[model samples]
Target: MTQNIKKLGYFLLFTFVTLILYLTYLVMVQGEQLARHPQNQRIAAQEAGIIRGTIYDRTGTIIAETNWRGKQGERVYLKQDQLTPFSHITGYVSQRYGAFGLEASYSKELLGLTEADYLENLLDRILNRTPRGNDLVLTLDTVLQRTALNALGGRRGAVVAMNPKTGEILALASSPTFDANEIDRPEVWKQLNQDKLNAPLLNRATQGAYPPGSVMKIVTGAAILSQQILKPQDKIQCPGYTVIDGQRIKDNRSHNSVDFNKAIALSCNTYFALEGSKLSWDQFEDNFKKFGLSATPDIGVPVRSGTLAKGERRNLSQLAESSFGQGDTLISPLHMALACSAIANNGIIMKPYIVKEIRKPNGKPISVTEDSLWLTATDPEVAKQIAQGMVAAAKWGTATAASIKGLEVAGKTGTAETQGNSLPHAWFVGYAPAENPKIVVAVIVEKSGSGGIIAAPIAREIFSMALAR
Candidate 1:
């Protein structure tokens, strides 16, 4: 009996140690996640009394604010006309549904938890004064955002516009969107969740991943050029099709023979398939990763990382197809925008950001975002060479619709084929005033006909409006 008791004591001690270690691990590794979880009642209770901050656009246009109802704060999204346009960016804060988007990502600042003055917080706590959160100044331009949504014309799509040199997101518009104010209704929420086809709650601009189509030729051409596999003036014969490992990939039409720049301008599938097929797996994958695929943009909100097929499973055929942006590769609108921004900014991709400043309730600045380098996609010379090809594309090729009169526009268009019976997704990525780019835009129209027809025109309007500012 004594021996049995000793064994039980040993087991109890071991179990106790394991439990302690598990708890420690949770605290060390997942403490923040647990605290910020939507279902965390403790967090909800703590935030219930705090008056959240107001949100404003780059032009000081009010986006959202809070209304106090006797210690219970209610979030009221303003700008009635822009309710749906800014919904995905501002998100909603609810006692029942919790918070999301900028609201959840910067909740601490919105709850006044990260105030610069600890003594003021102490005094407020001692006096039991009502807590107010900091105000957020975002980089979004209201006019540009509205223009982007209007250009979509209620189509299911997304547009991301940003400053190439600074990475300040000027507009992020995702269509088939929802009004955050209505999400509080159980019936409305149920309907939104049930509509899986549109997925109104999903922020397509940053979250939706789609095949990039010929727009990916940008990366392919850059990769081949960087590796000395092809030169800008190198000529390749395009007989309307090219075979890779017994599979024939067809181009839009036969170009007979064209140089690298002309091939990009015309989006010659044959040229890219032949040239890209020469790249080794290491070179192909490295260029894609370097251009910001398989990684999420650090923009203080949820963003889906671009994806690529497993390297080990890759073959010559798959590589050829992926060279022009097909196969298992996928990229988000924001990711594509950053890639084009790299070329416009002298080969440097700046870190993308939305929030420009954080201000106290009294209008004093607390924090500000500064532009920083995220990646060097290629040498300046290589980027310049690629930019020239895109200029030609915009001038008279597939991306002509995106060109503005008297403005040197540089861009590439893509018509990404979809699965099943769905139509192809239209894509256009580019920047304005090629000599001195001011804004870079990425537009994707889901299940649309062609990038030049369906997407490039929209980018033109966005660029026109942004430059007009």
Candidate 2:
């Protein structure tokens, strides 16, 4: 009986110790993910009565802050310039509506819940002190963001601009934006939630996915050059259209046999569709996967992954369609911008980041961001050839509207045709000063025919503004 008791005691002690260790592991490993999770209801309660941190633009413009003196969180959206343009960036936080965007991504940091600040606050708890949240200093440039939004002119699309070298997002503007101030009201919430046509609540910049159209030709071009399947100057004949997998693929215009540069510049669909057929499905998928079409990039807000297909077994016709950004292929504006930025930055895609710094409540710097490489999709030589083609497109081809006199911009235009009655979506992705690139911009105008006419001009204005800075 004593032996039985001793064995039971030993088992119970072992179980208790194992449970404690497991909990400690969870605290150390899963702690940040748990605290920042959108489903954590405790965040809403804490936000109701806590002094959350301020959010600022790169230029020190206060985008969001809470009034702490009265009732803990009189969450105030300051009437700053270009506030509406940044609505998706500073997403709404409410007890009723839940949370998303930066409000959710950095919730733990903003709530001062990270393990680094834990023990300091434990001492505060002993002294009965009210803890303050940490401030986020974002990388967004207000002037650039406003330029992008205004350039969109209330269209149903988005624009994402970034520093190609550093991956610092200069501007992220989604069209049909709503006033964040109206979020607390029931009527406004219901109206925004139910509106089907515009869907003003959708953050089109990072979350909305559309057929990439000719802009996807950039990826196709990368694959061709990287795999050594085609030379930069390889000649191909385009008699308006060509048969691919029994489907007659048509180009925008008839062009006699031309080299790779002219094909890319003119966005000859026949050339790309034919080139795409030469690649096996594995080669095709591998190229785009390297370019991040298969996954969501790590950005400050929520981003949906752009998809190439729904299944593993892809038909030849599907490959042709996917080659030109049609069929089942869809991509987010930010994703395309990053891809273009990769080309601009010598094939090294830097990881995109918005928040540049984190500061304590008293304005002392906690940490500063260090830019890192996200992917090396191709050789610099291959990327340079693609860049040259983009420059040709800007100078003498479909992207002439995007050309800025004396600035030497390199760009690509895309008009992705949609099904049924929906018109083609206009797309323009580019970088400035081909020799020494600075800002890379991606502009998409929904159901807008002709990327050169509508989207390129929009991008031109943004590039003009960014360069002026």
Candidate 3:
């Protein structure tokens, strides 16, 4: 009995020692992160004396700033009247609500509290003077952003526009956006949180995940071409429906027989389903990963990682459905824009960024963002082949609504079928001036009708405005 009691004592002592070691590890490694977390009210209290930075659009128009009244700084959003359009981009800052969006993402820099400025901060503290934060210049175009917001017509969805070659995000807009200026109010904050259906606070562009519908055909087509499973001239017969693993997957209409390019233009699900069945799961998944479809995007704000079902877990019918974008695969509007950008950029996907530069309050630039490559999805020639099909899609196929009068737009449309009787999500992803591609835009209208009818037109307006600029 004494030996057993001694053993219990030893076990308790070991567990206590392990707990101390873990606490020490956390303090040594994650102390700074824990302190800077948005939920940590200590940072907010400390920042009361600091003047937060101003945020500007690419054209130098102020979007957000802190107005000083005596020694107190009041965070103000300049375009609060047009609330929803800029809400997700600027986010909200409140001692009560903490911070969100860009405000939270760059809190240290915006508060003049980065480790690099420690000496300067100390000196300012010693002098009892408030330190002004560095201002941020974003790549977002206010005019284009507003245009996208208006184009959505107040639907529940998102729009993401970017420079395909440079990777500068021109606009990121999510509908049903709440007013950041009013988010600090207790009642308003409570209402926004309780309204789960609309989810006005969610950044749908980066955070919302939906099944990628027919738009995923782009990845499948690229993979099919890259693997030489099918040549551009290779022919396939697409019946209205194709049976796989004892389940039938149907296309909207039948294309009697089509070459590779024609199949993509028509978005023939039957053709893609058959093609998908031919490739091994590893080959199929590798192509999607190459485009970074299932990865968390590196950007200024927080984003949910794109997700797809594991190949090993999916049966033949499930794989066929996924091949046409109807499986368990889900992605964001931002990711779809990048996929379109890869084809537009000669197969190179540039890392998308929103911030253009950081400047001191005196207007001296401290840091400027440079364009960098994120991924090489395919060879230039393969991208050309995909572009040809996308061009056909925009010109005379399902995505004709996105075509501009003088510009050759290359695009793909998706009408994703959803469960529980709700309307399918409409999707359009494309780039304008196909040969000399300038802008890539992705649009999705939740529970909307057809991609051709609803989403494509919205992208057309954004493209026209962007190219006009």
The TM-score leader among the candidates is 1
lDDT of each: 0.89, 0.86, 0.88
Could you say which candidate leads in lDDT? 1
Worst 10 residues of 3 by lDDT: 77-86
TM per candidate comes to 0.96, 0.91, 0.94
lDDT of model 1 at position 462: 94
Model 3, stretches more than 4 Å misplaced? Answer: 1-20, 311-313
Question: What are the per-residue Cα lDDT tens digits for candidate 2 across 1-469?
Answer: 9999999999999999999999998899997787777778877776654578888999998888887775566666644454476789888777667666888898878878777778857876798777778999999988888888888888899999999999899999998888787787999999998999999999999999899999999899889888878887789888998887688877888888977789879998888888887888889989988887777777778898888775754888788878888888889999999889878989889989999998888888889999998898778888888898899999999999999998899999999999889789999999997899999999999998999999999999999998888
Q: Model 1: runs farther than 4 Å from truth?
A: 115-118, 311-313
Scored against the true structure, residue 87 in model 3 reaches a CA lDDT of 84
lDDT of 3 by residue, 1-469 (tens): 9999999999999999999999998899998778667877877887788899999999998889999888899888866336546789789888788888888888888988877678878888899888888899999998998898888877899999999989999999998888887887999999999989889898999888999898998888888888888788988787789999899888898898888788878889998999887877788788888997877876778787777787465788888988988888888998898888889998999988999898888888889999999999888888899899999999889999999897899999999999899999999999988989899999999999999999999999999999989
Evaluation by lDDT, superior candidate among 2 and 3: 3
